[model samples]
Target: MMIHGFHSSRQDFSFGPWKLTVAKMHVMKSANVEKLADELHMPSLLEMMFGDNVLRIQHVSGFGIEFNATYALKCVNNYPGVLKVACAGEWEESRTMGEHYKEIIRPYDWTYTTDYKGTLLGKALKLKVVPMTDHIDTEKLKAREQIKFFEEVLLFEDELHDHGVLSLTVKIRVMPSSFFLLLRFFLRIDGVLIRMNDTRLYHEADKTYMLIWAIQGLR
Candidate 1:
């Protein structure tokens, strides 16, 4: 988690009543804060990290007690003068100090409250007081589409081979779902089909990798 040497004094902890110490307020103000992730129906992101399963992050600078989507929605619904609340997915911003901020939030969707209601705490915090809630969208891709796409694009190989100075053999079944294209090569040496090596190629747009087995012939 990131500590900006600033503290806040919030009370409700559910929404705007929760305040950050003055120091933290200054930090948030000075830093360009952004959400990096947007998930649904999950507790605070940090809570999940504490569990036995290790959580993985990409391009993460640090962690913190982030603004809760539910809390933000509630504050917007109940309190006046609250601004709009919205869930933001992975975000990165270039800031003045030559430091970049990247972060992720959960539930992928959020509510917005306006600050026109003017709660004393909200005024002090200079925030609109949006509260996040349990209302989450449950939309998913259709099963047929998923299956059809996978069937055409993805393939698995039970065995593969490579040819080099000496032939090599592998026993694992490699799948093509993750990578763009997978090529398998087999070489005959001493009446035995052997595998030389495996190469992985990644597609830039989707960031997917393709494996090419037995690529030793090229320099």
Candidate 2:
């Protein structure tokens, strides 16, 4: 069976709320925090960025409905209260899979003194990032078996056909108080599992935020 999940609405993809949260976190203020960025809330963010109909299948063995990056970016631009798209680059041709995944983990600077610094542009982009190691150590599975497993699990299931996935589960860290992070998951089809983790900060060009990702096809 082909199982799929829904992303957030079209209005929830902006980094404004996420940026504001970071500002508050840095200032150590306890005021009421409203969610703005998709990082903190993946489902809501997905919904907002991709809409309820982002993924759908026509029939078994048929090409499923898909969403594209152009559409995804357009949705991101539609959110309310966006000061501007702080992220730099065209996103389509500018970023590659490796750079894009790196951006998702902490896409913000966890440390205060980085190139991007404390601004949303800095905080939303990734600086130095790495992919997590696959923990399955074994002589039982042949190298090709392992390779095939990972390829089926990670690369195939992800929404890569549309927009390349920027930042995956291995890098993202969700809040425990609300338990929003626990519900999130990376894609795994046959045997591959990508657990994206969130780091802090992103990379930018010419004083503008750029979408960064860290990608690995592993066994």
Best by TM-score: 2
Model 1 regions lying over 4 Å from their true place: 1-179, 190-193, 204-219
Least accurate stretch of 10 residues (summed lDDT) in model 2? Answer: 147-156
For each candidate in turn, the TM-score is 0.16, 0.18
How close is each model in CA RMSD to the real structure?
26.6, 20.4
lDDT of 2: 0.23
lDDT of 1 by residue, 141-171 (tens): 1112222111111011111111112211111
